[model samples]
Target: MKGDDDASVVVAGVRVGSFTRDSFVDRVLTMARGDSTRVAVGVNAHVCNLARTDARLREALSTSTTYADGQSVVWAARLLGGHLPERLATTDIAEPILRAAAAEGLPVYFLGAAEGVAERAAELLRDRIPGLRLRTHHGYISEGDVSLVLDEIAAHGTRILFVGMGDPAQQYWVENHRDRLPAAVLTCGGLFDWLSGSNRRAPAWMITSGLEWLWRLMIEPRRLARRYIVGNPAFIAAVLRQRRHETPRRTPSGVL
Candidate 1:
């Protein structure tokens, strides 16, 4: 809500914020220092498609500041006559955010990923940005246990919380608890694994070519097959449908 709602385009009924990397980070960092709590959600094709069916996801995006984290979503927006300054991939945004947190002396919390992963990532982040106030909690908790996690984070005085529990669940948690938190939150799904170096990114060439999905599929086919294989096509179809509905057909006169 703190971002440019006018610049956002409705993707499957969810307003996806179109922000450049610097602008997105600036908005979030500024919000973190505000009087009230704010949340930043990374929206991609998979997330947009998920929003169509998941009421929790829809509600989360309705209130959270979202950045375009997928190339597919950028292309889809262009086809629908919407402009995204550029792809603000969540992984690319994370380090800069951490740097800002360190500069502000804001204590940060990492919540998600497998056991030991968050601990490992906190070490890396502390090394990457000296004087960073970092904390870790692996995202293995029942709904009954979330309050304990929240209490611990509050007790630690965390100002920036990164929740990487993936998709709708992460969104749902942040939505339900943002009011209770004293921090700005981001649902950066899978970011802890990547930052910890437990999961390697695709080669730079492949990432630039937008074939990172293929690289991930090659590495974790069993896990990502459905998301990349099925979700991708579904996303494209939804985009095309939205484009047709929102854009006017040109007559032979080349005018509406």
Candidate 2:
């Protein structure tokens, strides 16, 4: 991965890389090359919104390899003079990571999303990347059933685990189970839904203009109105305030 010279601030002790999608992928791939396990967290508007008041959640988010998931974050980074090129949506990242895994013969496990979504996503991935070794466990299982899911992942010898249980839940799962699992996990929210065609993504133009949230609000107005309209702005203000109170820090040039 090419080194980025942009400024980086430490949030909850995690040194987030202020880089574009390609650089972020390179950095993640470099982390994948190491002996120790590494986990990556994709922070979208919802997660960022949650991170504002939840200090423990922020600390957990800081522990993983963090990437900008919402265009708002990309814009904020640019405003902070980092120049992040594009939003790295996990729905998009999933394809590239699966392609890379297929090429490297890595075993991947899909965890989360509604009952058939993960399975359908695995099927879609196989169609996209022939001969890909992938396993999946649906996200609708009860909390009591988590043990069985964990056991299945361990049995499959999963190298990469793509989690799609949404924020806080996905992050909490990864944090609690990271020590027990042998695989490197990536917390991806609703990615399976998008991949399975259960949830449609907004048009590219809307996403580019950071109006994807608006599109989502239009689709699920009652459910998403407070989140996008009210929660997002509050989160942005919190991030800016945090940035103002801190100084940029350098991350070690190696895997987590």
Candidate 3:
């Protein structure tokens, strides 16, 4: 992904790329077919909150392209007077991208998730899209495993590598090894969890109404309680503060 597009929106001080779902998928697949390496990451309230305080995370985000991955982020952009096409949940976009990759006969790699989770997700994908060239590795890798994982990725001739080790860590891993990778990379937080059936997505109605976080909280309250209950308000407050310091700008579409 390239640097912020002309129409990119600053939400809570993080630049979120304005791309329709199709365009983003096309860009990623195009990058996979190219020689040079590029990275794309999804943005949500959790990521925005972290980027506000973590310089390293901010650096990772600044270098890679970003997309709106949460409804809250899309709402925040609208609240701050910017336009994003839609909320592109990483899980939703991954299927289309993989389908395209399958049609093109490009090898795709899934790296992250707990042991056997990525493999399970890969199995589901293989069933979903026949003839998808895919490979997998668990996210729990030791320092010595880095070289092995890279070798496997290279050996598999991966064109796109989806890293799902969660935020900051996944971003940092890509940042640390960007130069060594030969494929287009995307940091996908918890995508494997959903795909592997370890977590369930919200109902379509909840998702469309921007209550997916509530569903997530309902299912995994102990884990996500702080993130949603505490972090969400903090993210909203930060966006409001940012709005106070900046002037709203009219943006056009299709700049990227």
Question: Which candidate number would show the highest TM-score if scored against the true structure?
Answer: 3
Which structure is stronger by lDDT: 2 or 3?
Answer: 3
State in Å the error of residue 81, model 3.
1.3
In the range 1-256, model 2's lDDT, one tens digit per residue, is 2236544534323345455666766666566555566778776667777776778788786566777677777666555445545677877777877777778777888988877788997898898797699998888878798888889987886778888877788777778877766547788877888889888899989987888888889988998889888988776776677668766334442322
Candidate 1 residue-wise lDDT, 198-246, digit = tens? 9999999988887888998999999999999999999988877877777
lDDT of 3 at 160: 95
All predictions: root-mean-square deviation over Cα?
5.1, 3.0, 2.2
C-alpha lDDT of all candidate models, in order? 0.80, 0.72, 0.87
Ten contiguous residues minimizing lDDT sum, candidate 1: 247-256
TM-score of 3: 0.94
Model 3: lDDT of residue 44: 95
Q: For candidate 2, what is the total of clashing residue pairs?
A: 0
- Model 1 has an lDDT value of 0.80
lDDT of 3: 0.87
lDDT of 3 at 18: 87
